[model samples]
Target chain A: MILEGKKRLWAEYQKEIPDDNYFYVRSCIRQNFFPASEPTFLRILRDELKKDIFETPFHTTCSGIGYHSDIVPMETTMTVVARQFALMTEAGYENYAASCITSFGLYSEIIETWKHFPEVLAKVRKHLKQATGREFEIPQSLVHASDIVFKLRNEIAAKAKFKLVNKHTGKPLKVVEHIGCHYSKMFPSKGVGGAEYPYVLVGMIEVWGGEVVDYPERRHCCGYGFRHYLVKANRGYSVANTKKKFDSMEPYKPDMIITNCPGCPYFLDRWQYVIAEMEGKTYGGDGQGIPALTYEEVAGLVLGYNPWDLGLQVHQIAVEPLLDKIGIGYDPEAKYKGPNGEDLGKPEMPMSIRCC
Target chain B: MGKLYDMLVEDVRFQEGMKSCMNCGTCTAICPAAEFYRYDPRQVIDTVQTKDEEAIEDLLKSETIWYCGECMSCVTRCPRKNAVGLVIVALRSLSQKLGYFVESEKGRQQLALKRTIGAWILEHGYCVYPRKITVENHPEAGTIWKWEQDNLDLIHKRLGSNLDGEGNGGLRRIPQESLDELQRIFDVTGGSDFYNQIEEASKKKAEEMGLSLDEYVKFVYTTNNGLHGRDEE
Candidate 1:
């Protein structure tokens, strides 16, 4: 609980995330869960910031979920990841940026494993060669996409059309930022600020004019324990764990929650409705649940991107209220419209939680 | 050391995660699973460190090994720098490989994972595809999910996702060549064999429990042991 001690630890855990010219890999679930996030990230880096980030069609899933679920062997995950690195090498990029925290953690684990056991690395190399006839060198930089965002927060803040502060009250929004456990828990030094108090999201929140809330259970997992949520029966544990976090953060009365991980935002957003339905409890003021947003969505909003275009409408917990608080304007009719502006129809309202 | 302990050490995860356990209970104190389930990382590591073959076998067959969520929170706090979560990973792999995973309810969920995410990886090159997450399987995904599932292509297109299309973007169709290479990697490594082991073990258990394979899949997918709410502590 010592402030200076934590500051010292955070200082010690600062990572050297690369500035530009990186090879990116997409998440298996992030695309489906929060479809706009990866695109927003690319748009922010490529269009807005004018950085060089290349993505290849050849790269596939890193298979972290299967590995964590214990269904896929570590050797499979290692070889699959080696194939991804091979793709990056073929594309002539040395810095690797992963969109999913699980993939980031798995990549870090594999690299560390190879460092410890050269025989295993050699075996993975042999398998990759036999499978795809490809060879790869280790990426010079292995970073989560959020780390890139954190590294370039000031650049983003300079281009902002709005801030994380509420214009109505002239107060910084009380933002609860949740770092994915795998982002830093596996290797503290690999993340922007370390596990207990990861600064990847915090740096962005602070730089964009928001007050970070340090709730007691701020370090708790969002409960997307791969096997826990993947299996229908064991999902109680997942929701129960998420419910524990919501209960702890509720007293803080934050305006919104921001997460860097794919599952963190998905589960945090959806589990609010589940908790509301199960216990008739809501976290946000009035009968609504708190909005759980990905860091990219928040960035896109501050950078003046259209809310619907950022896919805020797809969120289970309506983000319109948070939008109103931030003084961002949006047409309610456009929430469910398609790309060419066709009406996509409205989602049915839930009994316990309010929806737009 | 017993035979089970010997086999456990063979996994690199075990070798890296298990160090000298002083039983400081820091890992148990911070373990979220221990708070809800009748599980303790301290005790689990102690049991493993005992190197008792019978105890290790019992650990594998029981629900204890399956309770860990593998969040790796324990790795952060352990004074001895142990990773009980990774140790659990090693244990679970050994459990599934040895056919002991079918003995417990939570462990039996491996077949469910294999069929869902595992199969999805090989089929679509993603763990959780948009089409695969249906209302029937994931009810808690809420009403918005139903709407999203109903308008999958339109919504993804609006969000600028390449969803089933080729090239780089959200949910884009992984190229057939890439998928073929992935399958080859799985075949070259032990992934296909591991999947087969899960399927065969679950099938044998299903027959022994007087259920068909499909019925067993449904049972494992939906059956709640009510362990979450039990006042086991």
Candidate 2:
């Protein structure tokens, strides 16, 4: 845990992410779990930052979930990813921005695999040609959507209506920035700040006035193992890994956990509730558990987007306390309203963990 | 080299993932699954390196190969530069192909994944869609998920999404033509065949255990092996 040693390592891992004009692909799970996250990212990129982030409806899942879960063959995964690249190429965009870390890691893996084995790449190209009659040139850059946000963090902070600070105490908010294991663990140079001490989320937190919590288990995975969580029988392993993380981070008393991966935030948030139900324990200050937020949600907060509009209400853990700490006001009544302002019924509360 | 070793080396992931194993225990030391389960990547790599068909067959049929979460954390810390996670991927693929996956509880769950996400990919072009995630299947998703599921159209609309709508947004309806291409890709690349193998193996296992296919799906979906989070080995 030498400070200078980690600093030197982080310096070497910086990536050259593009400035603008990107092709964005949505995550299968993130869009389902956190419906607003992808839209929030689009808004932040296209509207707030005024970047040219193009998206196409034809682009489909990378089959990464199936690939990592062992249901989809590697060749199938590669061809599907090639199809995505074809879509990107057809759309006339070169910078590939993926909303899911798994997809990012898979793309990195495929690119590296092709670099090592041209014959495999040729096979994938033939498969794509036979199936879709489409040819693709690999994009110049492959980046996670968070990398785009990290690249423009200072600009976002300049336009921010709020900072990641406890407005009442006038102190920086304590934040736990959890990097997805695939973000850099698979290919260290692909991520913004390498695998061990990824600085992508940390850059945003620091720019927006939050103190990053360097807990001991900081490098441990959030444990959204594709198979472990997808299968109900193996979910204990998923929750157990997350529990290990929560147990490690509990002593830090961080205000919230921020993550770049789709499953990380979902598992980190939902597993806290599951742990509370199973073990009667909570990690936050009171009966509440820590709010596990996506990096886009954290960016949305600092940009002064309404909490409900950011889909903060969709979380299993309550986020009202964190919003209150940041002095962001929201109407509790509108939390369950639909687009037409109709009353969408509120959810039944959990037993142990507090929910709004 | 043995027949099993020949098959293992055929996989590009195994080719790229397994460089050499000196058994320094770095991969095992950093493995999250190793900490929770009676699994060690170092030992698994060592066993595979031995190229012993019997031991490799034992690994394929046992629960050991299925325990990896595939976080690839081992790839980061391995001094040997070996991607043990990728080796696990290759092992699991071989296990499924040879019908040995159904012999273990965890590996047998591949059938559930095939029917759910694998089917969902060919059907909806998305692995996990909102409509399929119900409170009954995913109670951990909490009550808010129920509300969201109930008001899917409205919630997505409020969030500025184009759910099930045409052309460009979150949860947008993937065009039928694109789905046709995806289906063809799966057909040509043996993904459909791989899925069938899982179903066939699972069906035989279910029949041997005297349960219907639907009943087997329920059993695998809900049964926890209790192998994790235990105090004893």
Question: Residue B13 in model 1: shift from native, Å?
Answer: 0.5
> Lowest summed-lDDT stretch of 10 residues in model 2 chain A?
A5-14
Q: Model 1, range A1-356, lDDT digits (tens) per residue?
A: 99999878567778998999999999877898789988999999999999999998888889999999999999999999999999899999999999999999999999999999999999999999999999999999999999899999999999999999888999999999999899999899899878755788989999999999998999999998888889988888899899999999999999999998988999999999999999899999989989999999999999999998898988999898899988999999889888888887889999998885
Query: In order, what lDDT does every prediction score?
Result: 0.91, 0.91
Candidate 2 DockQ, CA atoms: 0.85
Model 2 spans with C-alpha error above 4 angstroms: A1-11, B227-233
Comparing chain B with the reference, what is the TM-score for each candidate?
0.97, 0.97
Query: Per-residue alpha-carbon lDDT of model 1 for B30-89, expressed as tens digits?
Result: 988888788888999999999999999999998999888989999999999999999999
The C-alpha TM-scores of every prediction are: 0.98, 0.97
**Candidate 1: docking tier:** high
